[model samples]
Each structure stands twice: as C-alpha cells, then as structure tokens.
Target chain A: MRRAIGLILLLVLAAFLVSGMLLVHPFGAPYPTDMDDYIIENAQNQTGSNSVVASVVFDYRGLDTLGEATILFTAVTGVLLLLRAQKRKEGGS
Target chain B: MLSKIVRTVANQLVLFILIFGLYVIAHGHLTPGGGFQGGAVVVSGVVMLLVAFSSQDLKKSVRERVLSIMESTGALIFAILGFAGLGTVFFYNFLVGSPIFGRIPPTGPNSGDFWTGGFIPLMNFAVGLKVIAGLSAVVLAIALFARGEEMEE
Candidate 1:
C-alpha cells in the first residue's frame, strides 16, 4: 500500500512537471520582453556597466543576490556546526 | 592518498586553476563568467589539492578557522555594500557616475572598461570569496571526519 501511494505521488509530480514544461514558451521567444528590451538598451547608460547581465544582477536585482549570499552563509554555518570536532573524554576508557 | 606522480601534476595545475578563477571573478562584469563560476573553479583547485595529499597534510595547510573567517568576511562585505546604497534605495548604483568604477561605455559592442560596473565587481569578489571558502571548508570537514572514522576502525 505504501509503495502504491509513493508511485501515485511520483506520477502526479511527473504530470505536473510535464504540463508546466508544455505550457512554457518556445526557445528564444519569451513572452513580455518589455523589461528585457529596456534593460538591454539602458543598462550600460544607467549602471555604467558594459555587461547587461551583470548590471541587472548586481544593481537592478541586488536584493535577490543578497538573499542568495545569506543562504550560502546559512549553509556554511550549518556545515560547520555539523562537522565541528568533539573533545574526547580523557579517562572514559 | 594518490601516487607521487599525481601529486606533482596536481601541484603544478593548482596554480593555473587559481589564476583562471581569479581572472573569471575579476572580469565578471566585462566577461562571460561570474563570481559563482569563478569560485567553483577555485574550489575545484582546492579539491585537487585535497585529493592529491593526505588529510593530515591538508589540515596543516588549510585550516577550518581560516576558511570560516573568510566566509564571514565575504558575507559582511556583501551586506555592507548592499546597505551602503540606503540613501536613495536598497542596492542603489551610487558609484555609477562617480569616480570609482564610473566609466560609461558605448551602447553597442566594444572593448569593455575595467573601471566600470559600480558595485558589481565588488559584489562579485565578495560572493566569489564566500563560495570558495564555504565549499572548501565543507569538503575539508567531510574529508577530515572520514579520516577520523577510519582511525576508529
């Protein structure tokens, strides 16, 4: 019974993923490109950055980058916590 | 640990890997690669070193404390840079028209400038440092723990 339920869940997830992929726009032709056009045209002038992608990532959407950095910080902290060295008892043996 | 031949090759290759990673990080604003890619590259170099040497040798050279410190410093720098733009808005490009990193380029394709992309290059460097330190520390910890487990057996 558990295996049956697991299979059903997996099938449901696959269906959702397939439907989503089917609904996505075709390659190289994204819908609602106004923002893209604007950024492409004015990124260099506004941000003074030659790389449009960099300007958008670091300047326009910088808060997202901050959040990404925070997530990385949290992950590193978790690793340190988990792998920290534990002291051995001197006389336990 | 691997043989002496593998260790020698890794030692020689590590320098080139580090230099390439630095190049990618520094030229992120003007080139294709960015901080994440460059940092991963650097971490790969560290991994190569780790694989080539014993855990004891790795511990002597690469300390967990140093990597932790580097991670913290990178995060702090990133946060400070973000908060520095609070005068106008969050993450404002204040250095765009100023002296530092304030060189505007032509619209179309041309040779890019080094002194452009206000706050971008700095952020890239910070993120790069964070990723390299964090990943290397994690791998080092895991390797050390595995070695400890072997000793217990």
Candidate 2:
C-alpha cells in the first residue's frame, strides 16, 4: 500500500511537470520583449556601462543585488556560528 | 588528502587562477562576467588550495578572522555606496555625471571605457569581495570541523 501511494504521487508530479512544460513558450521565441528591447537600446547611454546585462543587474535592479549580498552575509555568519570551537569554563559545570 | 604531485600542481596554478579571477572582477562592466562569477572563480582557487594541503597548514596561512572581516567590510561598503545615493533615490546612479566612473558611452556597441558605469563597478567590486570572503570562510570552517571530527575518531 505504501509503494502504491508513492507511485501515485510520483505520477501526479510528473503530470504537473509535463503540463507546465507544454505551456511554456517555444525556445528562442519569447513573448512581450518590450522591456528587453528598451534595456538593450538605452542601457549603455543611461548606465554608462557597455555590458547591458551588468547595467541591468547593478544599475537598474540594484536593490535585488543588495538583498543577495545580505543573504550571503547571513549564510557566512551561520556557518561560522555552527563551526566555531566551543570553550569550556574552569569554574562552571 | 591529495598526493604531493597534486599539491605541487595546485600550488603552482593557484596564483594564475587568482589573477584571472581578479581580472574578471575588474573588467566585469566591459566583459561577460560580473562580481558573482569572478568571486566564484577565486573561491575555486582557494578550494584547490584547501584540497591540496592539510587543514593545519591552511590554518597557518589563512585565518577565519581575516576572512570574516573581509566579508563584513564588503557588505558595509556596498551598503554605504547605496546610502550615498539616498539624496536622489535608493541605488541611484549618482556617479554617472561625476568625474569618477561617469563617462557616458555611445549608444551602439563599442569598446567600453574603464572609468565608466558610475557606481556599477564599485558595487561589483564590493559584491565580489563579499562572495570571495564569505564562501572561502564557509569552506574553511567546514574543513576545520571535518579535521576535528577525523581527529576525534
């Protein structure tokens, strides 16, 4: 019975994934590229960066990058906290 | 642990890898890679060192405190740069018209100027430093713990 239920769940997940994939637009044919076109055309002039992707990431969407940096900082803090050696007290139990 | 031959090769190649990573980070505004990519490359070099050498030897050279300081400094620098633009807007391109990193490029594709991109390059450098220090510190911490575990066994 357990195996049967697991198989049913797997089948349901596969059906959902397949349906989602089918609904995706065809490769290299994206819809509503107005934003893309605008960024490509004016990124260099506005951001003064030759790399459009860099301008978009660092200039246009700066807050998102800041958040990513914060996440990395928090992760490092967690790692340090978990791995640091513990010191024993002489008087305490 | 790796063999002596692997260790020697890693030691010799580490410098080149680090230089390449720095180049990528510095030229991020004009090239394909940015802060994250360049920082990952640097971390890969550090990982190579960690794999080639013993934890004891690594501890002698690279300290956890130094890496932690670097990580914090990078984050602080990024936040400060953002705040500098607070008069206009959050993350504003305040340096665009200024002398530093303010050279506006032509509309079409061409070779990029180094002193352009306003605050973008600065932000990239900050992020790159943060990623390099953070990831290397994490790996170093894990490696140290693993060494302790082995010693316990």
Local accuracy of candidate 2 as per-residue lDDT tens digits, B67-148: 8889999999999999999999988889997999899988787777899899988988999999999999888878888878
Question: Just chain B of model 2: what TM-score?
Answer: 0.93
Candidate 2 error regions (>4 Å): A87-93, B1-4, B149-153
- Sorted into a CAPRI-style docking class, model 1 comes out as medium
User: Could you tell me the lDDT of residue B136 within candidate 2?
Assistant: 92
Model 1 C-alpha lDDT per residue in residues B19-115, reported as the tens digit of each score? 9999999998999888888999999999999899987788878777788889999999988888888898878887887788877888889898999
Model 2: how far is B70 from its true place, Å? 0.4
CA lDDT, candidate 1, residue B101: 85
What is each predicted model's overall lDDT from 0 to 1? 0.87, 0.88
Worst 10 residues of 2 chain A by lDDT: A84-93
Q: Write the per-residue lDDT of candidate 2 for residues A15-40, one digit (tens) a residue.
A: 99999998989988999899999999
After superposition, candidate 1 runs with Cα above 4 Å error: A87-93, B149-153
